[model samples]
Target: MRIRRAGADDAGALALAGAATFLETFAGILHGRDIVEHCRKQHAPQVYADWLDDAGAALWLAETAEGAAPVGYAVIAPPKLPLHDLSEDDLELKRIYLLSRFHGGGVGRELMEQAVAEARVRGARRLLLGVYAGNTRALAFYARNGFEHVGERRFQVGGNTYGDAILALDLRR
Candidate 1:
């Protein structure tokens, strides 16, 4: 797979990829319109486009060997809402999604590597991410990547409330 930084032109493609991966991954857990409604707000092309315009935001896309559409993506930026009192050197891994076919094939790992490296390059001391508390797979993935549970937060998707574990990795380490 190949990875690259995204620009404004990639907004639509990124939105589709984000929505697809999110729906596919959460289909079993989230039911019906809940998933659609969440994706509508979170994965809209305008959302990504606006972020692309932000100097503080960075986005990366991963493509398969076939070089078709992107299969996964990652975003790192200053936290929209700091979980607590964040210093200037903290960045949040806003989102990372991969199609099911790419799971366990190192796609996610590559994305993580790029995101963490970018975070450090931008002089961030800590990298924080929020993952569904019940998502054992993602929690394990973050743990393997040297992230530790720092706290928990309530994540609302549509009308549903989900517990999300806040994980953090110290870049200085």
Candidate 2:
């Protein structure tokens, strides 16, 4: 697989991969209707397009080596979480997802490395992210990467609200 910077033209692929991964990850854990509604809006191509247009945002897409089909993506942007201690030099790992089939193959790690490198290049001191509080696997993954739980917030999905754990990794480490 190859991970590359994503542009506005990649909105569709990003949307597809984003929606697919979201659904795949939350299908059994979250309410089906909530999953559908959440993906519909959160993973829309227009959303990605808008992010692409933002000067402070960056996205990377992971694609298969053979057919170049998008399999995963990661996005980093100016802090949007509800952290009161956020600083101008901080960034958020707004999203990072990969198809389940590609798990454990190092693609996720590559995506994460790309995000961290980009954040450092942009002079960010800390990188934050929010994850479903109940997602043990994801939480463990983040912990392994040196992220520590720092806060919590309510995440809205469709008409439902869920708890989210905020994690932060100090780039100065």
Candidate 3:
């Protein structure tokens, strides 16, 4: 697979992937109707377009082969709290999503590895992310990949309460 920086032209595909993966991954963890509703609002093409232009953001797309379309993506940025308490120069993994078909295929790990490398290049000494408590698969993935639980908080999604676990990986190590 090849990884590359995403351009504004990729907004639509990125949004679609985001919504699809969010829905598929959260199926049982969140109410079906709520998941659909949230994805619709949050994954709009314009939102992705704006994200593409944001100076603080960096998005990477994973493609299967030369000239192949993006099948997965990861976004790392300055952080959106209550997931993090950003210190200057720290990097936050805002979101990481892979098409369900790409799960367990090493794409997610590759994306994260790239993110850490980029963060280091940008002079960040740490990386942070938040995983919903119910997403054991993601939590396990983070744990296996060197992140440690740092804290927890409550998150309200579609008016329903859920636990959010804060995880951090010190890149300086």
Best by lDDT: 2
- Pairs of colliding residues, candidate 1: none
lDDT of each: 0.89, 0.96, 0.83
In every candidate, how many clashes are there?
Answer: 0, 0, 0
Error in Å for residue 8 of model 3: 1.1
Better of 2 and 3 by TM-score: 2
Per-model TM-score on C-alpha atoms? 0.95, 0.98, 0.91
- Candidate 2 lDDT, 14-37, residue by residue in tens: 999999999999988889999999
- Order the numbered candidates by lDDT, best leading: 2, 1, 3
User: Top model by TM-score, which number?
Assistant: 2
lDDT of 2 at 51: 96
Ranking 2 against 3 by lDDT, winner? 2
For model 1, residues 134-162, the per-residue Cα lDDT tens digits are 88988989999999998888888878988
Query: What would you estimate as the lDDT of candidate 3?
Result: 0.83
Q: Point out where model 3 deviates above 4 Å.
A: 83-85
Name the lDDT value of residue 126 in candidate 3. 78
RMSD of each: 1.2, 0.7, 1.9
